[model samples]
Target chain A: MPDTPKRTVFYVSDGTGITAETLGHSLLAQFPEFDYDEVRAPFIDAPEKASDLVERIERVKRRTGLRPIVFSTLVQPAVVAVLHRAEAHIVDLFGTFLGPLERELGMPSTHAVGRFHGILDNRSYQRRIEAINFALSHDDGIIQDGTLDDANIILIGVSRSGKTPTSLYLAMQYAVKAANYPLIPEDFERKALPAPLKLHRAKLFGLTIAPERLAQIRQERRPNSVYASLENCRKEVEEALALMRREGIPWIDSTTKSIEEIAAVIMQHLQKMQKYADL
Target chain B: MPDTPKRTVFYVSDGTGITAETLGHSLLAQFPEFDYDEVRAPFIDAPEKASDLVERIERVKRRTGLRPIVFSTLVQPAVVAVLHRAEAHIVDLFGTFLGPLERELGMPSTHAVGRFHGILDNRSYQRRIEAINFALSHDDGIIQDGTLDDANIILIGVSRSGKTPTSLYLAMQYAVKAANYPLIPEDFERKALPAPLKLHRAKLFGLTIAPERLAQIRQERRPNSVYASLENCRKEVEEALALMRREGIPWIDSTTKSIEEIAAVIMQHLQKMQKYADL
Candidate 1:
């Protein structure tokens, strides 16, 4: 086989470029054989910035003897026209779909910039911030009276089974009010859900991990302690899984899953229960 | 006005569907004059799931007398084939770009599913989790000795000026170790930077919000108190801005900006300073 092909890829947009980058990454992940040098060109809402980006793309092309691959979500016509001058394979994320959408809807696009990620609606934005605050305050089983009533989902598992990160991700990404509780040894010994969680059974979701992984994670936090021992991890995980099964809480293994995947699973569970109708 | 062109929109994907939803939202935001009923169909990796989604789309189209719009990132050929059978305007996010990318790279895509948001790289995932922990521990100026040294960025601002949320966003989205410090009245009375922040001046970035917005946010947390008073808010903001300016720290107004916009601005600042070369 010839040497693995290499190319430069750019995720360019008028806003934060996060959508462009996210979609570009999903597309690129399908082709794992290629080596890509990724660059982010965000806030490129002006013709001058587009021109500068064109220059940079051209420089990469000249240096590599290959045209770069540009994934752009740019909406401005003038700025896009400037970028078209570059010697690159431009994947126009917006232009490709907007025309058909406009025809389908019988109207023209605003060609606006900074609208996707901006604080367009104050109420929704405030809701997201409030969700983040709720997640932070209610994290690690810190529950006040009637606080769990507001949570859209409550994650429960042994320590370091990946609750805090998932709670925050749910809050940040989808504005879901997620609180997490750790299933301590005391709860395991009693073979009953914590009193706070028992009152909110409908909102409870579980996360479990392989004992080895749990031990590895805990080792980093507290080495040479009973909490970090493999035997202890095994006992805790077994007890937690048994408790979740007994309580009929839906759960997924998080040992090899990202926070996004875990959160998506929990959201699907909520949807199935008809508790997240608006999500 | 033609019933605002009401129609259903679907974000379909083999994974979390977040990329499709994000890109679809950005595209639809440009055509803000129309009405949309958005739905998410995630984890549609198999042909059976795709067929189910197609059926749902057809039902929506039949009900509305218009074809539903679909934004999809499905990678499997069989799933894509099933989805194409739907009576809708399908925006194939991957199909449109992958063909050109394959030809450019002289290789076919792996056609694998669930790679983008999955935990593909364990080290990177762990880094993100660690970053989230760092953000939580160092939040609101809860700094221990030498803890600030590991931060990728330090956000300083008055309380409720959008520091905590911004720090958490940075950590969750980009694996950025962001720590935030509140510029309190004590620091302002001294008319100098906080002592801990004085040591790591280079990593410092400031956030300031409109006094009215700050007062409103504080009012939600503590009602009928001097801490939530508009006069106190105005004075605190003035002092914080003066201190940031005097200390030569760059800053942004977070009054109307989303956490994404704020994080993007901070990342750009770090890039300009050559501190975020890898990002």
Candidate 2:
């Protein structure tokens, strides 16, 4: 197979640039055959700033001989125009959705550049902060015995199976009070659920990983140690899966999955459980 | 003002529903004059699941006599058909971008659901995990003496002024190595930069908040205490802002800003610094 040409891509936003990058990644991921050199140009509010971005984009295009792709969420028409003047393929995210929304709502959009992620006074922001605090305090099974009642979800997994990052992502993104616990050697020896987790079985979600991948991840942290050995990884993962199966806890294989994917699955499970309980 | 009508909005996704919600929020936030009750329906991979979502949307429409808005990123054509049958507005994110992308790339997309956040094998995912780990270990200035050299950005702020969440968000989202330090009462008394932070002043970013807001936040944690008093909050913020101005360190007033906004500003600053260094 011939090598696919590398293209330059930029996520330009008047605010956090997260939404632009996220949607751009989703669009770009569809065509994984092409390699991309991605850049983030956030806080592009003024016309001057947009002109500067255009210069940067044009520079890249001239050097690469490929028209750069710009994914922008600039709400201001003037700034968007400045970016459009550049010799690139531009996707205006706000321009795409806000029109339809305005027609549906019977009003024009405020054309605000950064309203989506402003002000800590909003209820959602407060909830996210609270969730972050809860996650940090209860991380790694540091909770006092019998104090797991407040957690919306509890993650159980072998070390380096991606419980911690998943929990933090869930809390930060979704305001979910996620607590994670490592399935230690003692738990495997006991062949039973840990004492603190026994009563909260309903909230438990398990994570497992391929032994080879787990060994590689563990090796990065503890090189040349038995903890990073494939045999130990295989044993722990096998035992953890058996425990989750015996306990009827839903589990996911985290070896090839990202934290966002793992957290999403957990959230979907919780939503389903809540819906069922409500019914 | 009269009571605005409350509208129902759903973020429907074949995967995590994050992209849908993010773009939906950006659109909805433009019309904050109207109230919204938001729902997330993740993992709608099948036609049956899409049907269930339509049913829910119809139910909400019937109850309110207003059609609900559906923002979806479902990649499957059959499932998308099921959603199109619903009596509501549908914003198909993948449907919107995929065709343009496919045409540009001169190849049909794989139409793979949830590939944007699929695996941990990517360099971006690994960097994000490393950043998360770094943020956790160096949180609240817990690093040992002379150990702050690894930090890409150091945040200094009065307690609860949004430093910790901003640091974590920067790390999780942008793979930034962010370390935060709380400006304690001792620093305020000294009327000087903390000894540990003085050497790393080039990397410093300060956060300050309105005293009343700070008091309200602190009062929630420690009711009726001096630490939560408005006077103390005022004194600390004043001193912190003074220190930042005196030391010529850039700062932000975090009283109303969300963590995402703070992180964006910090990233923008970092980008400028990098560009300057390159020049």
Candidate 3:
């Protein structure tokens, strides 16, 4: 056996396990090297269920002769009891907030909601707030429309340039209103910023990615759109960048950066360039 | 002083804590009983940081004179040291996996993704799956130019009918791609499903809300769209529901149901009537 214990995350949520997946995936996405299995412990509603889950984990450990790390979000009397004998490294999500929550609610507990906050510079932080608003509000308009008034930073590129996923990540994580507009062939013909963008010249930022990568993402959505073509993607991206530079709008290449990395850079830029009252 | 012990949840991972929140929030949303202060022990990159975070949590316990619960994802030996003598409720995330994740990557997991598997059957369970699919897709085309094919059901009502928020909640939580089409005066005059929805006859569902509530939600956004008018709202909802009944399409008056409740009802309808693939 290896020197290290095997690790598994048990997200024993009260309902479906996807919510845990969202938080867990984002966390795991940060550490590429840390490999772990995901278990959605559904219907962990009662104290007995929590304790049972713990006991099961213990049995598995003794049977396999392997001690594994356990992560759980179970809040029940039985869960609290089971914790006493949990053999592996434990991360009790419910335990972290039991005090403040109990005080606030004046109850031993009934359900669970996690209150996790991250601190950032006020100005930079506000951009994230607006980003979330923008992302949630203007769905497709984010791509087809070029208005950046609500946007702290505008990501412009051709089809399949990794715009939508990146925008979503920023908005979901930081509440950043990251509006992304695709530079259609028509825009490329004149090679100018869309007229709506003329008013907000300073806040515009562009993103470009590898042509092959762009093709891959596009292939999944509209495999037949000419915009997804490598030649078309490359040409449009090149022209969009040139236009952004000529218009004096800054740009970032999204070729290698993770969604988190991209969001962090954009947040920093928005703070430095445009600190607007986003809400 | 509060009588309950100060509750603390130990959220641990080698990665950032986004995924934990997904599971954490679901539990919170479902239970709504347990409340806790949150501290994320994220970026426990190496064994040493794990030790430090473990120590800090212990200190928090000592300073507060309460035993803290630990939710951790410690996989390294150095990190396990901090867990020692912590005397906390430890829930390790990775403990569910019998072996290291690396060994399981290519291996088929023991768990089921629930496709084509025979299990206990219930209408509610079936609807939950359908609702989840609806929330997952959030098909924009359903709303574009007024096409409702993307939705298993069409919600027709004025603004503040809680259409958008409800649609979003269903889409995000259950993966249901519910589309809401605002029924307007023009819709009644044309006396048909809005132009876009005319084509999708089978998978259309409708909703109507109280005029006052419509005004409330609309007032928050545009505050002035004729769509917000209670009188207009009432007329449109009434007309649209009539048209739906005339066309042999069914609808629900959503004025009373919470978003989840509304989603639940729609899920039932979809399962019984529409043969939509869970794909």
Candidate 4:
């Protein structure tokens, strides 16, 4: 019993600690018995915050008496100075970046130099980029609101629908700020875009779940509720989709599709619209 | 140029977030016309920071008026209640935990269950769990006095010999509370582990890098110094590995192997040694 294998928790950062943690989480999920926790030390705005990051390395060293393996994103001298004392096994993510990009461009390491901030500067695909960011943020709102202003996109849909899961899928994976507002009874009665959403009518993308499937999901959440009844769900679905159509809004029927599929459909719609507008 | 593709950022908690980001990154990376920034949000501890987060989301939201994907591990009812009102997309990580675990275990949904609490029962694991908490809270001065009494293992090696990277890799990926200390001139001259480490000698793991690689890595920093010279690196590595051998200690030579290989080797070594001792 005592011989159970103890695990090592690693922190790998690709410059930003958040990216490393997100990627690391994916790696951990592949192996269930393993559990990895991450504490990000980002170097933005207050670069001085990274000075305290060394303290973090030390704290772990003290508490766990074992040297950890680090996949680090930091390349700054001051930060490296702090980490040197820790004597950890490190994988420099920036070190890997140079080779791949340089080779791609047929150039010698352009890191920190001339016209090379990567894709952080191009401005033509702005709308698609915005939609992607919005998609990644908010997932589950009982009231779905799909509009561009004050939203990555307003995700309007009924409860137990695919809105939350899809929105979450986008946000967690992409660092997209997604805000979803529900299409509630109040909105339906008023028969207009929610007041906050009225101004950005163009960015709206509606999510419609099948009435039968919606009932099934709701029943699982609440075995008995007027809210979960199939008859009630049917009426709501019929009304919501009709309203979206009448308002000249387009929506995806997420009934049988997976989360990825729903998101892809939304992305495609956004991309096509952007292209059309450009032309 | 004004219509360039935008950068999309994602703040996430698990593999799902990583997967989504990869797709999103691919899309943006493929279309260089867009400019967007992506970031991961590490696990946050409290609710007081809600507004600060809301502002970060809103800044991006207000500028683009498009939802940026914000994948959240924020399941705290209070935190969720607030973030729910934010202008960004909220991709909820806890939402997925509901689907698989609920179906498999027949359990209802809940949020913010500290992952450590869910997987451990034994005192040693609990101690490590606590160590992570300690590391998180006192990421400052925790390395002082070298009394990492709570540590399970200590890694030591010459500078840039891949110490920090390995330590973080172990900690973030495996959850091993690994603490790495550099084998510096002072300790090397004494031909022994640091004075503070003698008490916990059994928890030591020595890493020996090829003098050539060690020198090459150091050259990136100091450019040219006796300390960063091939001779010094060779001297340090030879001395350290020899010292470990003299003490009947086991060590890993990290010369040719990649970080992944070195970690896998160490994990296997730990497992085998644990088994040997158990028998």
**Stretch of 10 with least lDDT, candidate 1 chain B:** B117-126
Candidate 4 has a DockQ of 0.02
Q: Output candidate 1 Cα RMSD.
A: 2.5
Instruction: Give the least accurate 10-residue stretch of model 1 chain A, judged by summed lDDT.
Output: A117-126
Ranking by DockQ: 1, 2, 3, 4
What's the TM for model 2?
0.87
**By TM-score, highest first, what's the ranking?**
1, 2, 3, 4
Residues B78-184, model 3: lDDT tens digits: 55556654767664444433244435333333321111111322333345434533533434334432334546555555444556555655543445667666666
Query: What is candidate 2's lDDT per residue for A1-279, written digit by digit as tens?
Result: 956556888999998888898889888777777777878888899999998999999899888888888898899998888988999878888888889888998988888778886542277777889889988888898894349998999999999889888888888888888898999889978989999999899999999999999999899889989999999999999999998999999999987777887887887788778732321
The TM-scores, chain A only, for the candidates as listed are 0.94, 0.88, 0.68, 0.52
DockQ of each: 0.74, 0.54, 0.12, 0.02
Q: Interface RMSD values for the candidates, listed in order?
A: 1.3, 3.3, 11.3, 14.8
Q: Which candidate number would show the highest DockQ if scored against the true structure?
A: 1
Minimal lDDT window, size 10, model 2 chain B: B270-279
* Model 1 per-residue lDDT tens digits across residues A9-45: 9989998888888878888878766677778889998
Index of the highest-TM-score prediction: 1
lDDT of 4 by residue, B1-279 (tens): 467434345554321133444323432332343345665443344555666667777787777666665555554567666666776545454443334433432344445333322333233333433433333222222364346786656677776766554554454334565677777777667877677667777777778888887898678668999989998888888888777887766788877544444555565566555732320
DockQ of 3: 0.12
**What lDDT score goes with residue B170 in model 2?**
86
Candidate 2 lDDT, tens digit per residue, B117-183?
Answer: 7652388778889888888888897884348888898999999998888888988888888888999
